[model samples]
Target: MNSSMFNKSNATSSIGENIYHYLRKGIIELKLKPGDSLSAKNIAEQLEVSRSPVRDSIIKLGKEGLVDIVAQSGTTVSKIDLDRVAEEQFIRFSLEEKVMMLFIEKSSSREISKLEELMEMQKANLEKKEYNTFLNYDDEFHSVFFETANKQMSWELIVSMSGHYRRLRLITLWDLEIAEDVMKQHYDLLKFIKEKNIDMARKTVQEHTMRIFAQKDFMVKKYPTFFKEKNDEIDLFNNFKR
Candidate 1:
């Protein structure tokens, strides 16, 4: 923990952050498996906190697409759906490709080096089979490019949508071949950005995103239970919207 993180105020140590980190990590590491029922009372008791904090944390998780709230059934860890994953990837790829191209055009050598350092950390975490660590570092690695856009709102939107499909990304991380491919793509993208190759950087980012999308069918087949059931009647009705 750093001093900046530890500095306490009214907001500090609030039940929200405590509960949020607990569930966020659980979901990220698959500790709380998909469709597992969330017990607010149990969690609050375990952490020696009140249910209010846990409830707030649950709402945060819901916003991140990690929890499902049902009026009659209570809250459960969210199940992944292929269509939602595809939709999120499309949005992410749309923004990030442009961000990568912009970064390649405008970044200094210092910024490229920062990304390289994060990639190195990601590689080490992967070698150690630390999937969560690798995911965090990998996010940092990508954020370098996004931050260059100077569009903070876009970055937040990207991360929120990306969190929706985080479980799929976890699956990709488990396959060593896919992990190696990701690392290689990271290196390639970094090299292009450093060399001011905007076209190559943009293409590389698109290819990287598409590679994951290509694995969608495989993932869906292997993890059929991951997706939620779609309400096709509602979709059909929505299609007739004014």
Candidate 2:
């Protein structure tokens, strides 16, 4: 809608940018599964765009850790990197706790009402088995705290850097049991916020953010190909000789 976002001078509307978003969504939504081939030529043909743009898009996705570009085997959607997921979880838990606590001090009834609306939307999504839409609201629910606290940029930083973590979240939500737990945690957070209970709010933030790890095993087992194995931890090429 703005100059920087839509201007053709910076090539923001270039075929490459379009392709990047298209591929990025597929990766995040699990429409393009991990290890699925990413044929730039094929995509270029499908979208009626030049191969150059498709290649450019692939490179951009690679930088985001959403696509893997191997030396000889060609590119694919990267598997969920659990190590990165854990790191992201830690970053989110620490940062959001501070943000939510800040919100409790400064947020008004209006902001609280906004959060309540999002919760209702999430509930409707859950009832309809719209897991993807639920996750979108889940993101907005957390973002409200950051935005209220004047930390919108901080939330953007987390989201822009959380490709691996985001995909796993969608996969985890396939089990409505986990979705219910997540929803309860959101309500608990709301309760604490309304009460101006900083201590309880902080505790709920921790539980809410760290719940992903609690469900790690379930996620990995349920979607085996979706994640990299623990054995990947040993990068022996750097540690030993053949």
Candidate 3:
């Protein structure tokens, strides 16, 4: 962990929350990669805080499956579990589809204009090859649906459950073609929203939300260590003649 990444001057809030956010960002950004060891004492020294807060932050991350604490082996960043990623993706798709339905029914001209502005920003970011910034715009664009539908808390919950998925997205964002395709999908969704075409909007949203699954084989091949592979037991009786 880089000490410079931690802002020590934010003296108004809990030290544990500050450390948690710092470490969480590092993990999500792939700076502190899977299986990387984390030392509470070292982190405390770096952040100029007590080990107590660092320990607390690690515990919180452990709850989120972003950190793993072993009795004999110490603490390390957890590997991205594909099952967890799939679960979060399912939850997001389900909830966001509902939110989009509500948004299509409730959105006003002003909200549509705001989305257009965000789309412009996304295009600008893409032109600049600022993929991270583009992703922020992408998030904000979807967030408008939840916000307009009065589901900001639901959006937050989805975000909270999407750490592994976000990390995977960060990896995929390196591909310009994939990034451009995502932008195009965003535009299509926005067009459907403007036309109040509910069925088309739902279809676009479903395809957009589930597009990441198409990248699974490539992602797993490229980052074998980051992803988990399933090992299911074969049923001998099922394969045998009775």
lDDT (Cα, tens digit) per residue for candidate 2, span 9-99: 6554665676677788888888899999999888776776678878988999999888999988999999998877876766787789889
Task: Return the lDDT, model 3, position 229.
Answer: 56
Which prediction has more favorable TM-score, 1 or 3?
3
> Which of the two, 1 or 2, has more lDDT?
2
* CA lDDT scores, all candidates in order: 0.76, 0.83, 0.83
> What does candidate 1's lDDT look like per residue over 1-242, in tens digits?
12233223523575468568768878767888788899888877776667887888998888777899888889999987656666677777888877876776668878877987898899899999998889889877877877877756787787767655677888888889988999999999877776788888888888887686657557667776765767552343233221
State the local distance difference test value for candidate 3.
Answer: 0.83
**Clashing residue pairs found in predicted model 1:** none
True-vs-predicted CA distance for residue 181, candidate 3, Å: 0.7
Q: C-alpha displacement of 210 in model 2, angstroms?
A: 0.5
RMSD in Å for all candidates: 5.0, 5.7, 5.0
| The 10-residue segment with the lowest total lDDT in model 1 | 233-242
| Model 1 CA deviation exceeding 4 Å by range | 1-13, 229-242
Q: Which lDDT tens digits does candidate 3 get at residues 1-242?
A: 45544554644566677788889988988889988999999989988778998999999999998988999889999887766777777788889999998998889999999999999999999889887688778889989999999999999998888888787777787788888889889889988898999999999998897778778668778888886556521122122211
TM-score for each predicted model, relative to the true structure: 0.84, 0.89, 0.89
